[model samples]
Target: MSAYAYYPGCSLTGLGKPYDESVRAVFAHLGLGLEEIPDWNCCGATSYMSISGDKAVALAARNLALAEPMGLEIVAPCAACYLVLSKAQHTISGYPEIAARVHKGLQAAGLAYAGRAVIRHPLDVLVNTVGLDAIAAKVIRPLTGCRVAPYYGCQIVRPYSGFDDPLRPQTMDRLLEALGARVVEYPLKAHCCGGSLMGTMEDIGVRMSFLLLKEARARTANMVATACPLCQYNLEAYQGQMRRAYGEDVTIPIVYFTQLMGLAFGLAPKALGIQRNLVTADPLPVTV
Candidate 1:
């Protein structure tokens, strides 16, 4: 059994509670142990970086410092947390000045990180580390009747290649397939979900979300499986807004890949947090 330092970011504890629950449930089902990083703080998401690069790096590095002692790779379930942590590590390692400042910030917080810990997203851990064959072996209830659109949102694969092709990722799609789901061809899989733009610019955010949902519906997908909490929230929560704005009723359940995995693993629906979903009209087509 492989162990990892799990960093469930702010959103996961809040609006993305189901994602957090499903992540732990799926990992436990797969015999993967996750140690929660002690005293973890916010990753600063997309806001702090825009305000101050040095401070943002420091904030992200603080979490890395916390995980370094665990001596295991850190797996962040939230896409924004993964990106922020990855970007901070890359920037701090590449630039001496930034590293120095981040070190100082860590010192102020009574923490120290030597960049020994590697940051990874759950998708990368599942497909690359856990192996699809191992996952397929544990699928007790195959998702044979479900047609899923695997949505990758924007951050997980981008600016940090190697794990997958950023433009056309197939990790989630392949995993769903292994679970006996009919994976729909999602061309806009890597497109942005407007991120914070959904809050700052409602019109643009709703429009972008509508387009993605529209594409998924066009392909006859019953539900969209995502690896990012923000993407799940945006796509699921914004359907009514999109309909009011564009007169297109695109209502589909946006579920976390972990939730799907849990179902396939024969875990109870409540354990996977399926009931916490905002959009409950189109429930997951999985049964115990």
Candidate 2:
């Protein structure tokens, strides 16, 4: 069993609680130990990067600082959390001046920013470290009948580049395949799910979410499996809003890929966070 530093971010406790729970369960099943960073703070995500680059890096650095002394690699499940934290680590490690400033910020909190700890996303740890074969071996309820739309959102795979194959990511699809789920090569899988649009502009967010939902349904997918917590929340929570706003009937369930993985491990749906989904339909498609 491999032990790694875990950072759940803010949304995990709120909108992404299910995702958090599912991830923890799945990782445990795979014999991975996740130690949460004590006194961790938000990664500042997209908004912080736009508002103040240094501050954003500092905030993420604070989390990294907590993990460094412990000599453990940081692993995050949320795509946004993973991206910001990894990107921040990349920035500080590459620039001495920025590293110094980030260190100073951590110092205020009685910490030091030592940019040596490896920062990884949950998918990376699962696919690369644990190996898809391990995940396959643990599956007791294979998703043979389910046709999943593997959504990557935007942050986890892109711009960072080396995390996964950006042009055509296979990590999620491969993981799903290992669990007996059929993959639908969604053309818009990498498209933006209008992240953060919910708080800024409700109308545009509804439309954006509707477009994604409609695309998933058009492809005849059972449900959308996402690596991003924000995407899952937006797609699931706003399905009704999308239908009402567009005057079209839409009922697509949105779920975290980790949750689906947990289900394949024969864990109960409620334990995997399926009960909270807005679409009230079984996400797993019955195989014919």
Candidate 3:
């Protein structure tokens, strides 16, 4: 029953509330507790870094500062938030001058970050800490007939280097299989879902998302599973918009890996936040 400092990020609280609910419900069912860091702020996600380097670093550092005092490992459900927070932690810890500047900024906010805490995506905890064998043991419903396309998005594992195998990531797939899902090799698993471009440059984002959805359907996959809040939000929220843009009525369900795991353990769909999704993909029972 290990617990980590959990940060649900801004999107999970707003645009991806379903993700937050599903992850919480799933982890709780798995006997893990996620302690929300008290007085936490946004990790400077997609916009802050481009706005100003100093502000971006400072904003992310504030989160580390809050988590360090508790001496718990930091976990982020959002890929963008996870990357930004991990990058800030690495940057400040690697450079003395930058560390000093960041400390000053933290002081202004009345926060002190030692940058000593370990930051990881929630999927890492699910695979590494919780262990696949434990997950296998609890799978009351094996996803035998279900074929899942494991989508990694772009930010969570990449650029962090060694967080996951760069070219070949098996974390999500292996976990899914342990829970009895027939994991399909998805070529666009690590491809970018065009992020915030869904709003600005709708065409490109839709094309990217549409292509991925097409690949899943072509592979005979029943659903797409993801570990990031943004990936889930972007892929799920934009399915209809992407269909309209592409002039086709495509209905593919995008889900968080945690949600699938919860279902494998025989947790009800309502408990895992399945009903809140904008897309309509039914959770079929695991035959095995």
Clash count, candidate 1: 0
Off by over 4 Å in 1: 281-283
Q: For residues 1-288, could you state the per-residue lDDT of candidate 1 as single tens digits?
A: 789999999999998999999999999988899999998999999999889979899888989998988999999989999999999989988999989988988988788888886889988889888899999999988887789989998899898645889889989999999998999999999999898899899899999999999999999998999888889988989899999999989988888999989988889999989988877634455532
Candidate 3 local lDDT, 1-288, one digit each (tens): 677899888888887776788789878877888899987888887788888887788888888888887778887888888889888988897888888998998898787876697988778888888889988999998977779999998887688835687666878988998988898879888888888887788888888888888888888888999877777877888877877788875578888888788888898888777778777766557221
Model 2 per-residue lDDT tens digits across residues 1-288: 679888999999988998898998888888889999998899898888888978888888888888887778888888888888878878987988988888888788788865786878888888888898888889888887688888888888887737677766888888889989888878888888889988699898888778877888788898889987899888888877877899987687777889888888887777777777666657463211
Q: What's the lDDT for all of these models?
A: 0.89, 0.83, 0.82
TM-score, ranked from best to worst: 1, 3, 2
Q: Assess the local accuracy of residue 257 in candidate 1 as a C-alpha lDDT between 0 and 100.
A: 90
Q: Candidates' TM-scores?
A: 0.97, 0.94, 0.94
Against the hidden true structure, what lDDT does model 3 obtain? 0.82
| Worst window of 10 by summed lDDT in candidate 3 | 279-288
Model 1's lDDT to the true fold?
Answer: 0.89
Pick the TM-score winner: 1
TM-score of 1: 0.97
- What is the number of backbone collisions in each predicted candidate, taken in the order shown? 0, 0, 0
